[model samples]
Target: MRRARLTFGAFGAVTSIGGFVVALIAACGDDRGGFIQNERAFETEHEGGAPDAETCFLQCSLDGRSIIDSCTGGVVETCADDLACGAAKCQEPCAAAEADRSSNGCDFYFAMPRHYAPSIVSCFATFVVNASNKPATVSLELQGGELDVSRALFRAVPNSTDLEPLEGPIPPGESAILFVADWDPAKPRSVGERVDHTSCPTEAKPALEADFGNFRSGIGDAFRLKSNVPVGVTWMYPYGGAGTHYPTATLVLPVSAWAKEHVVVNGWEATLQGIPVTQIFAAEDDTEVTIIGTKTVSNGDGFTGAAAGIPAKMMLSKGQFAQIAQTEELTGSSVLSNKPTATVGGHECANVPTSAGACDTLAQQIPAFEQWGSEYVGVGYRPRTKNSDEIVWYRMVGGRDGTELEYDPVKPPAAPITLSAGELVLFSARSNDAFVVRSRDAEHPFYLGMHMSGGAGRPPKVPAYGGTGDPEFVNVVPTGQYMSSYSFYADSTFSEHSLVIVRKKTHGDFKDVWLECAGNLPDWKPIDNAGQYEYGRVDLSRQFGPGDSFGDKRCTTGLQRMRSEGAFSATLWGWGAYASYAYPGGMAFRKLVETPLTPVN
Candidate 1:
């Protein structure tokens, strides 16, 4: 959608009439009289007989802007983007075009990090999970890199402990894990060498300026996964089993979800050298990205320079990407691009709680700023300790200024708080605790994310932050964007894996939600006393425990399926001795606004 405005003649503007100018700022500058939306009919002349999605959206935006232009207008800009709540009511299809961006897509871009890996270890995979009825055929290709390399790629069969080598395409309900690179391969592999991708490489070796282009797939190069069927994508780095792992993972949304703009977010602050990083990768050629709300970042490609809080631009070709890493957290940075592009935010390996001893890699493909939601139910992850609360970290990024935020049940101390555009609030949520976060209305959208800090730090150990798992990151799926069904996969490298589900209790078939292998969900508890939403957890790892492996083992590898009449959201989280990973089940990646799709994930 084009940037919209709601200028008013009488609201905070000086209109000159026959050499007589009247000052309205002092008389009408009291913040627009509470931002009320009154829908009125307007005749929109379209070329064809009826309005389609584009025409419908155009008319709706214009109708909203027209209404606000007649009102006090100083504060009613949020409604100009959508017809749903912005002064104009649109049809279901038109709203879907604007609101229902999901995860199904044909092309995806990913570049595993050169984490703060002090030592070397085997990196398990970057997975592509198929959710479609038809089989998913994929190609894991890299720019300027050899094809059909001697890599570790396997088709994971859900429900069973089967990691089948992928010589053929992914089955209808299966996923493939491609080991692109290992941290410390048996031997050093060159850019042209036929070996797997890199694990977390130490920043010293190859150095950020040089070796990154060789292996990091950033600035100069990138890895693109082209697929025949829409599939869900995720990546886990250095996923060694048990005590040998220190990992982080993120769910990759489809190209359809990519927008021309984004807001950057990252984990806690760390040492000057280990701060968070924001990545910008192109979906097509001739793409240009402009950044704002950021600190000075050394130009990765040397094509342009970046300065603090000033708009900076970067140009890219088809298979290229760039990064902006800083000691200062890169949260709230604005990303604007001419072509639809993907923006990923997180840390290569940073301290979770700002100065925590152990650090781990964090990565999550961020959603477009406009795709953010106003309501979310945050269900906590597995407790890091037995009989104790898990301290999960959550951050909220305001999409608009003057956002009045609230919480249900036990209102937080910071409840009824207000945030300006690009502002953020960070807080901790305990294990087994759930919070219903929201703003007053849909016009005040915000983004919420969950971060996991490793259990009590263990010093003198190889990977010190070694309690349950190192810091992990994943975006919280909004209740408004929930899906009725999901097909996903969990890496078996972890000692334990679980799914945290949040469902609207008001749904007619709330009790009909079903997990294929686990049968009906066992525990169902309300998130708050309002009883509007409920939370539950299913231990996928325990279901396949030592002795019970053969029981549900046939269908648990990469195609675990769940369905319900009412839409619901689920997060996949798994952890090893000191390693962990998490991401949303899946979402439909519909084109946002005038965004277009290029035929095919």
Candidate 2:
């Protein structure tokens, strides 16, 4: 429901400031001060010449004082000697004064003079009056609409003359800032998303969850409206991405029992409102409140409270919104503190250090003997291998002779590490830190190992928690879930060949950690039994595959075809996360080595 009002002027000058209407006198027909009629009849009546006294009104200065001269809309009539009354007297309020239609339930209507002399500027001064005298508090907003401020311009002020107003009131004569733009009524605005405020009183706070799967990724949650009152909330989504838009968004929350509140659906930030820092309990539970603006005002109903009007506009969106599935609200605290409250195995197998001592020691071996349920453990390792070493090494566990040791299913609990399937453990003897080990099966006994660079007082810190590095053949009894493992760092400086021993109560097997300098080789051929090896070798070769490939596919194709004839095929899987060696030639996989192998000096 809108209407347009028109005013006439001399040359066509009009300047409107907020609610105040300040029309210039120069725009009037004859350069006389008067309101212009928005009617076609007024123009027809005054088209020919100046209007008579009955049609127009004029004011002038007589003796340094304002005086009403005449109503002719033309020149003032000179009085004759008989009717000479010099003192000014008005028969009624001057037509110019009465033309103010701001009050008395009347529309202003006045006709301008036909013409005026070339020397007078036209101007009209209008003011806003405190009609009810109700403290004269008027919020001079730009759009005649409420805007959210907390997340944007969070405050309002008017202290001294240099007041910078984001939004506030203008004293009496001053008009609010008026910003107008050409708007077509035919244009349709996009339909806003729906919001539900069902859990009003008890949970006045609306929880915001970001949905990244929609056309425009944004935040949303549902709430229960306690009463038919306006509601608004502010949400801050992590900014900066291809799909991000404005810094905020503002929308209206309808009066409903249960409403889904979706903020910033269009990707605009300015359009967003509500408190920025909301208190969330545990991890995913967000705080809800009814009153957004005022401090103390609630509906007082159980699970349904209503506060005073919120200071901002509430922006909500509909379905098909943004979302990230298969993830939980993991607040910062939950990531750092691993609180071990529950245990599934025979013992309280939680937070047990994966240090070699925890796994290697015979006394602490009971925990490793227990079984495991579905769980995950994080293990950080420290490597000290040299850059010049040709082989990138990993710490190894149970594998005896031709048979790989069976992991315990129940006893000797296991805590496994959560490394991506094929991610390799790059060896770097740079740090002096202990690493943890966990098994997927809880019953597998845990073992610890140590790495050291044989300095004076620094005999590498043997993972004493599990056991010391024992290069000598030591028979180990099958205890809990875990079996025996090489508890010492494989010395790169030793005979260049480490010895591996399989110790059992009744049977035993032993092999050189490497192809010994001069010794009886096992019946297993190095090349043929490579798959049964304790470790595998990685080489530099181009990485290429079926549809998508890298490197010189044409050149590598001949070698790939040659290798295809062998018992092995080229690896399509990408290399490890971190680089073990600089293979600018790309990634290539060779045969796995069962026992320790020697490096060609």
Candidate 3:
């Protein structure tokens, strides 16, 4: 399966026969205009043949037009006008190019969380270039569980023996970086301390040697990234110091768009800074999940409990993940799965309500529940100093058992809050106003979460407004999952980025969208209770490039391709001095499949 043949060069024009020898001596006294001008120059040289010589000039132009039509005895046809130009120039579709078979392959699943300190959990899997002209050959596979390279450890940066060829063709639009995996918590040491390998740091030295020896602590492990086309998978979790770093990254959705039900939650947790975990995997095999909420089960040790009440049932197997550490606030919790499953809520260093500062470890990767949405438009997060006050927590989960909500500045704790199906309710808004959550009963669909307001660093002065800021988690893209097109990637070391869009507010005003990027566009703004709801914000730190600025280069990292005419749903939000993250630049509506050519009638 290694064939690379590309050659094309054909140019011949030696027609200097002295003006075609006086027009072929006046067409040999006019033998039907020199046999129709040499049969129109042999059908223009078989119509510029050359695909392996066009099957030998289409069998010599169908045996020279069948020997000039049976010896031309009955020449009532000037060779039948070159037999329709030799069957339209030597016909040959090659059986539809050998029955075209399309599918340039592209499977995905990524997760690497686990390491709140001694540091080392790097994982890169970039692959931009959403083809506009081919050139993509990416391959990656690291299935889950059982890699026991005999009590392994980890590090991989340019070293490999197995992890299946990753770095690939990736040309067309450009973007490629595959250094998957590098977890060096100082190499399995707890005895006498000290197991140097140069103490693991030379910018994390040429990694690619993992071995958490069956790794599985706080649910963090799942890998799969096959690609031959359709790419764009991101991952990053660097910076593990000062209570285990605070850098984050996202944009890896493609388990064929996973979805088998999910409602999971986590956005406000800060006992002394964090604790709200969640992690569920399972791409097949047995699957059978089921985890209602309000946790409370301990001894069995699946990862402690108590996020609401209780309801658990398990059976994962395919790359298993399961981590669930709750402290009460999983928002109506529900996870039902039977096949596709992939969740990843956050917090192990939260502090959003504890006055946003200090603790930092928020995650994201939850978007199923049939893509929840009954209309949502909450935007919040823009106050690191301006008199400081940018908190906006709002959780709502109820897909049955009574559901009913309708807010729009109705400042509540009111309006039929009778949940049940998955039950969850939490709402807040410290002023940076912009809210809405309609859903009388759109078949009982409801799911909205948006928490952003966690200052960072100097906290502990604790009083009421809670220190100031550092907690982050953004997930509110449901206007029925708006997405008129998108192609994300933006977390260039966080220094403060933004992109909260959210749309829907026609006739009465508020529906003017725009956000191109790289080519530049940006200009949305419209949130202020102007009727149906519409919000905007952009800022992308000078337009792109940062996450180390795509060193190896390829599509130039400025990856953002948006579109609009109405439908909207962005959400990118990086953070400043203390680090932050948020993702989901689009969702719902997927249909791309067009690579079967062979019908040149």
Worst 10 residues of 2 by lDDT: 342-351
All candidates' TM-scores? Answer: 0.73, 0.14, 0.27
Each model's C-alpha lDDT? 0.56, 0.17, 0.45
The TM-score-based order of candidates, best leading, equals 1, 3, 2
Which regions of candidate 1 are displaced past 4 Å? 1-100, 119-124, 144-146, 149-152, 182-218, 241-244, 413-416, 457-466, 506-511, 542-559, 589-601
**lDDT (10s digit) by residue, model 2, range 111-155:** 011011111111110112211101123221111233222121111
Give lDDT: candidate 2, residue 384.
19
User: For candidate 1, lDDT tens digit of each residue in 465-546?
Assistant: 3466767778997655565556567766576777888766422225456676765666788775555577877777742352
Q: The CA-based lDDT of model 3 is what?
A: 0.45
Per-residue accuracy of model 3 over 1-601 as CA lDDT, tens digit each: 2222422211111011111100000000000110121122211111112222111111111111211111121222222321211221211111111111001114666665563432344433332323212455554455543221211112121111112223436544334445455545546755332321113223323234554432223333466655544444555554221122365555555665566666776655536655676777876678877676645422123444332345567676676677765455554467777687878777666765565466677777766665555556676755545585644566666656665555555444432445666666666765356766555434556667766555543344432333323556766765544533354555443455666666654223344454434322334454434344556565565323332122242222234545443445677766655556666653541211111111110
Residue range with the least summed lDDT across 10 consecutive positions in model 3:
21-30
